[model samples]
Target: MKVHLLIQRTFAGLNTEYTSNPAIAQLDNKLFLTDERSVVMQITENPVFSFAKNEKWTCYSFIKRALDREKRAGFYAVRLFISSAHKLTNVKDCLLTIAQRYEFFIQNNTPSQEYTDLLTQINEKAIIEKERYTFDIESIRKGTYYAIATAENLEALFADERNEFVEKLYLFTTNIDSKLLAEFHLHSIDPLSVVKWQINDEKKALDKLWLENTAIPVFAKKLLSLQGAKLYFQLKGQQEKRELTGTNELKTTALIIDDADKCITSLKINNTAVKPQPYFELYALATDTLYYTLKNGKEIPLPITAKLSTRKLIVENSENALAKLWVNGEELPIPTGKKFEIYALTTDKIEYTIVGQAGKKTTVNSDIKTLSIHLPNRGQTINDNKKSPVIDILLYALLSLLVGGIIGYFYRSNTSEEDISAIEQKIQEKEAKYEQVKKELNSSQILPNNTATKTVTSTTTNTIKSNNTTTKTTNVATKTTNTNSKTTK
Candidate 1:
């Protein structure tokens, strides 16, 4: 793609600045700055240029207030020209995108960085050799050139007098904007005989002729050559915000950088281990599925492609470690190196517990392709064995005293032979008191247990569409069982 930007300050009615691919259009250096003594041309070349004369043209014009207008109110008129080998279907969008960018440079009073970069590319292309053409009777191709002279006069100029009386020649000069001409006369030795003969005595005519002879035609030809070429434009915030048109579904390249641990045996894509390189520039459609094979040979499909641009994919194994085996509705076991897995299908609900010093538990469902899990060190149990011996002695002494008192009461009741009703009431009261004391003692003790329990529940989300509306149905399966068990000795 090629571009030309021409900006003019309205108050001064002079060209303020221009940024162009020199191949598209070359202008005099005096036109760049606000110099009153400079001989400015009034003609503004059509902003849009087309290769073939009849080609449809699309370009943009903008009138904006000057950034600094303390002395007088003035505006800047900007003209934008774009050309390409492909038809630019999105011309308005491209122009708007460039306008927004150019406006920023104007506001900042700085030159366009994009134009600078384009010039660098142009310079590099200039180094390569290309075919050249000379303007002469023998070198000229079968193409028409402007001429004001009559057929007889043109024939006499190129005629070989020794061989023929007159040479057969042609002249096409009708409605040729002769005064609005350029250096179309330079190719011939006596160009003035054909071009200069008509332009004289009029100051305006001379000026127009000079302007036409400049690089304006080159710019027009550049645009014509790209009549049907297509162009694409992307702004900073466009990617994520733009609707998915599906037009750019073509394959895109992405550079993958694996900053994971070197201990990883392999990182496979499509069941093949990725070769070690500085980075892998994988090419695939944005919607295409690529698989990441787990250690257990389970393949997880991930879409890691981008469109129109090269994206960066960074893989850090320690943070995004894949589990050797992942079972729904079960506690996730962290590998020896404090690594855990946290990724599941978009509709899957995964619940896992990481038993460590803090005993962490969480339930999660991921919408993205990858998820990271960081596990801390496993939990430990502290046993107070020294206090256990003392507790055992106290328990035995209490049990012995309770047994002796019950026997003494039963013996005294039998020996005394008091009222039978009174004796029964006393026995009931004593039994109730003893039960309460035992309950209180049981509630006061705390013991350490080296066991972890996890309840697992698996859930799947399904969308059912009957007609226009979509209904979401969730199915859940629960498993209640102890994951880890240890009996105290």
Candidate 2:
């Protein structure tokens, strides 16, 4: 048997053209049509209709178009036309069964439930939109199942199931055409897999690599070298000290002398199998004062100024014996007992010598000097020529006189200037006071002279008034007398 299918892509509210055979011309303008071969058919006006065979068309045309146009495409409406040489019951059953089975297949294979429900609802909606076309099963190949899907709704119908269908066909089918399978090119390789493979390769390379332990050996060698040198110097010093001391027990005293003046600032004595008295008494010649403890617990002061010269012992005081001087098993002769001073220019190499009694009496009392004598030629000399005592005294006296004269001159000049300024200030003040007194005296003379003039004028006016009053009284008496005489007549 053979089945013929027609798929179409049409816009909404538009008619689509499809044909199975020339005898199917009755499908025009018809909502649904059934043939004598028990074929049931339906025509749907829904533009979203899609079938599994034509799934790619829906994705390319309708779904993409809808997305571009920003509109929602409805469920796929497939114009299913089922025909068979069997009875209508068998044909309907077979068609419905296929439809139901395809719905289940799509739902299982698809990525989303919404698309499966849409396809199932499209199948159920076929009865109402009855513009149907029918076909006989004999018209298609025998035992072949055919499906038609319109391109407009292809994406909506098979957007999720396309890849799954391709995979199934690839896995199950034999003698499948490569071109046909390639049409549904849907499988995509994951990009992260490639990156992960590269990272794994790099990690393998890093695991096989090695690094040298350079720092540890270098540091250890440096430390070992330093330790060896330190041990060498310590051993050398011990050897020198052992050679310097014989089998006899000797007390050792160390003194640190300053390089500038060769002054001894600190001293330490180490006595083993030797008495402290011998050590103290032996080293007393180093300084002017030697301090010792008496049996009464009193500290006694001894003055000693003697030093060892080249193979000879010299004492500052002639009473001190120099013939018995022997130091470190070396015998020394007695000199004229004149004190000789030694000096070192630089601090790098210090000179040290030992002095003791010449004869081995096994217990000879001796004195040693730990002197820090200053070197005359070590530092720069301002005056080299030695002057007589009288000339030095005269020079000191002249310098003092010169300094005193300069100081006295400065002091007298400063005092005289201050006194002159004070005297001038006093004279100016006294002259100002004299000028003010003269002005006051001239003003007093003018006021008294004007008052005396005013007094004389007042006295003259009083005398004239008295004389006029007397004259008036006399004239009035004469008039009265004349009147009385007239009255009598």
Q: Which candidate is the best by lDDT?
A: 1
Q: lDDT by residue for model 2 over 1-489, one digit each (tens)?
A: 123222222234222333343343334322222110111111122222222221111111111111112243322222343332211112223233434443564458654322234334433542222112121112211111112333343233233222212211111111233354344341221111100000112111111110111111111111111111111101111222111112111122222222333222222222212123211223311222433332212343334323211111123423332334333444444345345432221211222222243332322212222322112222211122223346434533453454344434443454344543443444345446534644563354322223332343344345335444554676689899999999999
TM-score of each: 0.20, 0.12
Error of 2 at 328 (Å): 99
Q: Model 1 lDDT vs. the true structure?
A: 0.32
State the displacement of the C-alpha of residue 421, model 2, in Å, after optimal TM-score superposition: 99
Candidate-wise lDDT, in order: 0.32, 0.28
Model 2: per-residue Cα lDDT at residue 444: 41
- Tell me how many clashing residue pairs each candidate has: 17, 26
Local lDDT at 61 for model 2: 13
Error of 1 at 138 (Å): 23
Model 1, span 293-378: residue lDDT tens? 33323555666633111112121235333333334664445455533333333334554443342344444433223333333321
User: Candidate 1: minimum summed lDDT over ten consecutive residues — where?
Assistant: 452-461
